[model samples]
Target chain A: MAHLAMATGFLLILIGAWGALTNRNLLRMIVAFTIADTGVNLVIIAVGYMRGRTAPIIDGAVSAADAVTRIIDPVPQALVLTAIVIGVGVTALMLAYTYRLFEKKRSLDIRDYTDLKG
Target chain B: MIKRFIALALVVAVGSVFATLLFGYTPDADLNLTARYYAERTAADLGAANIVTAIVVTYRGLDTLGEVTVLFLSASIVGLVLAKGTHAPHRTPVPVGELLTTGTRFLVPLILLLGVYVFVNGHLTPGGGFQGGAIIASGILLLLLADPLKHFSHSLISAIESLAGIFYVMIGLAGLFLAGGFLDNRILPLGTLGNLASAGAIPLIYSLIGLKVGAEFASILAALSETEEL
Candidate 1:
């Protein structure tokens, strides 16, 4: 399951990168970047998964004494939680930029805004 | 066509590299030293049933604080950049259906309750402030959809945001003065391990985080929606 998730994450990132690089629409590229962010989050979370292990939450089922053997890594989950929120923040910022760009140029196409291109 | 081919080639190369890395990865048979330490010590040290919460709210609390700052900064910048665009001509407000408006009015409180529950129980459960904050934002989003012309009071939102942020920093400072270190959960005595109040400052910090994050997201949503659709 972990391997499958990793593969899926890698595939998503590739597809997102391709879309972002080749697509001319600024909004579409932002969406693609978000997809890639999701992929990265998935990959980070999957790296912590271990077979035959439960979550790190200690309930009646998983005792503290046996938690070291039973629980999966907690660090990655914490890191990924931060990463996911940061991803949303970045995506929102990018979207704001996209909206401002559209407001100025009245165009969504990246090719239309070549003022910064050398 | 040439651009498409080049993009595909780049993707293929990157995918192959990741694939190789993925194939070589083997799930560790045992927890590493740090993981082992956290697993063994978390309950005794923080009295938090949720190890992830222990790690997030205490062990690496500074990073979490920085993450919240990043979110706040982004939301603020989004609001700032899009603030000028609202001066453009306003579109005629579309009336939402009666059912949708009523349903949203009915559901918003419940969603708010759920968000509060998730963050309040951050020390004992899988969900935390981040997830709960997003939920609250979704509730605000529903309200926005139901009333296109409804103005969310910016003062109220900013008040909640700033208060929660100030309280969070205060708690961190208090920890520095009274406890082991900055953002230490030990400032308050750890209650029973599985209880709602077990994790001392974890629940408090998470709840503060929830409020700040929810307010930030609502601010962003309001900023985005306030813009004139071009």
Candidate 2:
């Protein structure tokens, strides 16, 4: 089931890549990029999940032996969180630049804004 | 049309071959234990349950500091680009909706609270400084969108950012004196595990990161909003 979710996430990333590549609208392209980035983060978090494993928290009643068996891996969760933040930063920066580009060109289409085209 | 078709076919064929090769290969049985070892040691020595937080803010704090510097640099470049050349005269104000303004007025505080919560619980949960900082940045962006007239005090944001940057470096240097390595966690007393006071230097460093990222992002958003400039 987890593998299926991961595969679906990967599929979404591919679809997002396609959307980004084919789309001429700058806003749509940015949205596609965000979708791909989110898909990557989802895949990472899914990889960290283990069947029947509990969250990595220590309980007072749980014995030391039980703790080892029940705790899920938390590294990927941390990594995903980090990746999500980085994605936000990049997305925001991209949007800002896109806005600036739109301001100068008065259009959101990428092909129309090429002043340096030879 | 023929050239485009050939290029598409080549891309599909190469992608399929790579996917097939990846599927055929099995990863090694040995688990990547290095991160785990660092996590466990951090949890024990620093008394933090969220091993990931300890690793990010303590064991690998230098990297986080560098990441913040990169963000700062990016924001500087964006600001420079947005601020270049003479300002355009008599620019028309972009019309904003009342709904967005009213809605964001209520939402901004909640979003800021959640960002703080995420960072505060970082030592015990999945989130840490960077995630929470970015959340705070989004809140600032919301404010910027909702109220373009309400300008952010750039001086205040710059002061906070500069202070945080200096403090981060100072903390790393202090670690050298206390623990013989930059960003060493032994400088502060590691409290009991699962407690708020745990993770010696992790929370401190994370807090600094949060401040730095928040300020940097707010400045970037502000710079981006100015259409009359550049």
Candidate 3:
């Protein structure tokens, strides 16, 4: 299950990279970048997965005494949570930048912004 | 054509790296040193039922603070860059449909409530500040969708954001003075392992984080939605 999820994540990353690299539209590139972000998060989460362990939360089901053996790695989960939030902020910033660029160039094409600006 | 080929080549190279890592990857049969320590010590040290929350809110709290700062900076830049473009549309927008309008009216408050619940229970549950904040912003998104021209009060949003941020830092400072170090959750008594009020300052800190993050995201959404449709 872990391998399957990790593979899927890697595929998404590749697809996102491909789309971002080839796409001329700024909006599409942003979308592609977000897809890549999601992929990265997925990979990290999958990496933290242990075969038969549950989540890092200690409830009646998993006692703190045995949590070390029964839980998946919590560090990656924490790291990914931060990454996901940062991803949202980044996507918003990208959208804002794209909106400003369109306002300036009156176009969304990458080639349109290629000319040097003062 | 050449650009596409080069892009594909670069992608393939990256893909090979991922593939190699995947193939070489061997899942650890046991928790590593860091994970082991967190598992063993989190409940006793911070009393957070959710070990991930313990790690995020206390063990490595400075990183979370920096993450919040980065988010705040991005939100501010988005608002600043899009400010001039947010004038009301010159034309009337179509009615957003009865179901959406009515549903939003009925659901927005509930959604906001759920967001509060998630963050308030951060120490004992799977959800936390970021998830809760995103949930709240999603409610705001629903509102915008229902009424395209609806304006959120920028001052109110910024006030909530600033107050949450200020109080968050203040709590951290209080921890510094009273507890072991900055952002220590132990400044408040660790009630119990699974109670709502168990994790000392974690619930409070997470609630502040939730409010701050929600306000920032709402501002970003509002700014994006208010832009004149060119």
Model 3 segments beyond 4 Å from truth? none
The residue ranges of model 1 lying beyond 4 angstroms of the native Cα positions read B85-89
Give the fraction of true interface contacts kept by model 2: 0.15
Candidate 2 C-alpha lDDT tens digits along B23-97: 553432222465446434555576777666766777666767767777888787777767755444555556789
- Give per-residue lDDT, candidate 3, residue B27: 90
Which docking category, incorrect, acceptable, medium or high, applies to candidate 3?
Answer: high
Candidate 2 chain B: worst-modelled 10 consecutive residues by lDDT: B22-31
Tell me the TM-score of model 2.
0.82
Task: Write one digit per residue (lDDT tens) for candidate 3, span A16-95.
Answer: 99999999999999999999999999999999999999999999989999999999999999999999999999999999
Q: Which scores higher on lDDT, 2 or 3? A: 3
Whole-model lDDT values for every prediction: 0.92, 0.73, 0.94
Individual DockQ of the candidates?
Answer: 0.89, 0.30, 0.90
Please state the error at residue A106 of candidate 2 in Å. 4.4
Residue-level lDDT of model 3, residues B122-226, one tens digit each, is 999999998999999999999999998999999999999999999999899999999999999899999989999898899999999999999999999988988
Clashing pairs in 1: none
Model 3: pairs clashing at backbone N, Cα or C within 3 Å: none
CAPRI tier of model 2: acceptable
Tens-digit lDDT string for candidate 2 (A20-104): 7677899999999999898788777666666766665553533223544555565676667567766766776787788778878
